[model samples]
Target: MTPALSPAEVTINVVGALFAIPIVFGIFIKAPKLVVFGFIGILFCFSDSTWGQLETDANIYSRGVGMFYFSLLNLILMVAGVAALLKRLANPQGPQLAPPMAKYLAAFVFLLLGHVVVGLMQGIELDVILGYSGIFNVLNMMVFMYLVIMAFESEKDTQRLLLMIIALATLRAIFGAVRFFLFDGDTANPYRNFEGLDIKIFYFDINDNFVASLGAFCAAWLLTTPGVKLGWFKRGLLIAFLVLEVAAVALSFRRTSLIGLGLMFLFLFLRLPGTRKFMFSIVAAGLLAAVASVFYEHRLQFASEDDMLSSLIYDIAPSRGIKDGRFYELYAAAQSMDGNWLFGRGTWGTFSGDRERLSYHGDDFSFVHSGFGHVLLKTGIVGLLLFCGLLAAYVGFYMRHRNSLAGYARLLGDAGFAGFLFWVPTLLVGTPIIEFRTMMMLGLVLAMPFIAVGIRNYQVRAYQYDPRYAVA
Candidate 1:
C-alpha cells in the first residue's frame, strides 16, 4: 500500500491545487493562449525538481512523486498547445502561424520521431525510450514553442511576456538569496555533491544560476539599449533588479552562469557602433590588462600547477587531456558510438566502457553530463547534424529580420539572441537538453526572436493599411 500524506504534504497539495485553478479554468474556457502565458511564466519561477511544495535533490524523473507531477504538467502543456494551434488555424485573420525557421524545425522534429521508431526496433521499452532518453521533454518543448509563437501576436503582448519573465526571474533570485542567507540551508557548502562534482543547491533547485543569468542579461540589455526611454524611478528599479540577479548568480558559484554573463557582454560590445567600439576598446584593453596582472600574481596557485590560460584550457577543453570522470564520460560515450555511428544506439542505450566511473540514474545509463554527447549517443551523427541545423536556422532568422524591429521589439530580439548564445556553451558541457525546466526556458528564448519579428511585421502591415497605427 502507498503511504499516506502528512499534514505538511496535505497543506502543500491544497495550496498547489488552489494555485492551479486559474490555469485549469483558463483551459476549460478555451483560452489556451492565456494559459500558455501563465504556464511559461510559472515555469520561469520554478525549477525542474520543483513539484507542488516538494523539491527533490536529484533529477525529478528518479522519484515517483516528481515524475507524476512532471508528467501532469507535460500533459497540460500538450493539451493547451493543441487547443491554441487549432484556435489559430480556425481564424482566417490570425497572424502567420508558421515562423521563418519552420522548415528547419520540422526537419529536426522528423529526425527525432524517426529515432523513436529506431529505439523501438532496437527493443527499448517505450517508457524507457521516452523518459530516460529525454525525447518527450524535447518534443514537449517544441510544442510549447509553437504555443508561444501562436499565442503572442502583438508588440504589447510580447513586451508583456518579456516583463513577466523578468519579474518572475527577479522574484526567484530574491527567494534564492533569502534561502541561502537567512534560511537553515547550508551557507558555506551550498552545493550537493553529485558524482564527485558540486552542484549548487539553492532555493528550490540546482539551476538557479541559469535563471539569474537570464534575468541579468535581459535587464542589462534593456538598460543599455539606446532609445529605450524610462523614468528615473523605473530605471533605478531595473538597475537594482539587475544587481540582485548578478549577485545571485555570483553567490551560486556556477561557472556556467559566469560564462554566460561574459558572452552577453561580448554580444553587447559587438552590437555597439564603430565610434563606441573604438572608445570602449581602450577601456576594455585596460580591464584586460588588470585581469591579466591579477592572474599573473596568482599563477602558481592554480590546480593545474600551470599558468592561468593553461589551467583554463585544461579544465574546459577535454581534447587537451582527460583529468577527471567528467571528461572520461564523454570519451566513453564517444567510444560507445563506434558500432552505431550512423544512426546511433537509439534511446535507452548505454556506454559500458566507463560504467565504473560514471554514475547511473537509477538503473539506466542513458543520461549524460553533456547535452551534445547525449544527443550523439542516442540519435547519432544524423541527429547531431539536424540539431545543429535547427540552431543555425534560429540564429540566421534573427539576423535576417532583426533590422525590421524597433524599440522594445528590437531589445527583445537582441536580448533573446544573446541568451541563446549564452546557452550554447551550456549545451556542450551541461545536460540542459534533458532537464525539463531548462528545455522550457530554452523554448521560450528560442521563440522570442520570432515573436519580436512577427509582431513587428504585423505592425508594419497595419501601418501600410492605416497610417493611424504607428509601427512600433
Candidate 2:
C-alpha cells in the first residue's frame, strides 16, 4: 500500500495551488469560459485524486472534506463559478436564458433539490450530504453548464471547445501509451494485481480508457462528417491520434471500456449505408481478434477462449450455481426501493446498503457499480425517469437540429450522442453519472443544443438592425 503523504508532497501540492491561482485569475481576465474548459479537461485527464477517494461516502465526513479541499480542479471551479455569477449580477444583460433551455433546466434543478429535500425529511444528515459533497455537486454542475451554454456563442467557439476535448484526449492517450511501454514494470501483463496499484496507475487505467475511446469515436465522426475539410497532414494527424487513443484503451485491459469502444465503432459504422459490407468486416475483425488473442495469449494474459466475445458472454449469462453478478445487483437495487421507490431515498441516500453487502471488497454503498442502479437508488423511479428524460431531451434536440447545425457543432453533438450511447452497455456494470468524468460529459452533452444555435437569433438580428447593438 502507498505510504502517507510525505511533507515534500504536501509542499508540492501547496506550491502547485499557489501557481494555479494566478493562472486561473489570468484566464478569467481573458475569458471566463476558458476556466470552465480547464476544469473539464482536468476532470477528464486528471483522475488520480478523485479515484483514490471515490468509494468514501458522505458518511465519512473527514475524507469527504479532504476530497473537496484537495481537489484543485473543483476548487478552481468553485471560485470561477462564483466570480462568473457575481459578474452576471453586476451586468444583468450578460446571458439571457433560452426558454426551451430554461424549461429543461428548471425540471432538472427541481428534481435535484426535491430529492435533497425528501432525503432530508427521511433523516439523512444535512451536514453529511449537503454542501460540496457528491450529492450537492450537481449544483456546481448546473453553474458550469450555464457557463458553457453562455460562452459557446459562435461556430468558432464550438470548434475550439471540441479541439480542446481532442487535445485533452490526445495528451491522455500519449501518456497512457508511453507509461504502458516504458514506465510500467509489468508491461507484458499490466492488469496483474491491478487493484493494488498506486493511484496514478489506477486512475489512468479507468478514466484514460474512457476519454481515449470516446475521443477516438468523436475524431472518427468528425473525419467522416461532410463539411469537415481536413488537409492531408491534419487528417493523418487525426488518424494517428485515433490509433493512439484506441491502443491506449485496448492496452488498459478494462473489459467495459473495450466493450464501449466496440459499441462506439459499431454505432458509427451503422450510420453508413453498406450494411452487408459492414457485417462482413465485423466478422473478419472478430476472426482476426480471436487469432491474435490465441497468438498473444501467454504474453498478453489473454485468458478467455474466444477473445473478448467469450468474456462478454460470460459476464452477461448467469452462472450455474451463483445468483449474483450485474443481474443480481440490478435486482437487489429494485427490491431495495420498496416504499421510497417513487421519490427515492434522495441523492447519495443509502437506504438499502446494497453496495456494502454486495461489494467484493466491502466498499460502502456509495456506488452500486451500475449507472441505472445508482440513479434508481438515489432518486427512485421518478428521479430515474427525469434523469433519462433530460438525456432524451438532449438526444431529441440534437436529432431535430442536426441537419441545420454548423459543422463543428454537429460533430460535437454526434460525439455527445456516441458518448451517451456508449454508456448503455457499460451502465449495466459501471457507475458513470456519479463519476466526475462522465458527469462532465453529460453536462457537455446537455449544453450541445444551445451551442449549436450560434448566438441567439435575436442577438444576431439586433446587431443587424442597429449599430448600437454592436456598440453595446
After superposition, the stretches of candidate 2 with alpha carbons farther than 4 Å from their true spots are: 1-30, 49-64, 67-72, 82-101, 111-123, 131-134, 185-190, 194-205, 270-308, 318-322, 351-363, 455-472
Top model by TM-score, which number?
1
Whole-model lDDT, model 2: 0.59
TM-score of each: 0.81, 0.75
**Over the stretch 1-472, how does candidate 1's per-residue lDDT look in tens digits?**
1245567765775566557655664673465557777776667665554322222353322323332434446656655665665666668586665455567567766866776687788776667666635555666667777777777777778778778878788888877777767774323242343323233334334356667767877776666666777899989998788777766655554456556766776787787766566654664455434544433343313436676555545555556467463587777778777789877777667775545666443345666778788877877888778767777878888888877778778777887788787787778788777777777777877888888888788888898999898665
Residue pair clashes in candidate 2: none
Best by lDDT: 1
What is the TM-score of candidate 2? Answer: 0.75
For model 1 the TM-score comes to 0.81
Residue ranges of candidate 1 with Cα displaced over 4 Å = 1-30, 49-70, 184-207, 275-314, 317-325, 359-364
lDDT scores in order = 0.66, 0.59
Candidate 1 global lDDT? 0.66
**Which lDDT tens digits does candidate 2 get at residues 24-72?**
7657646877776766666666543223343422211122233334256
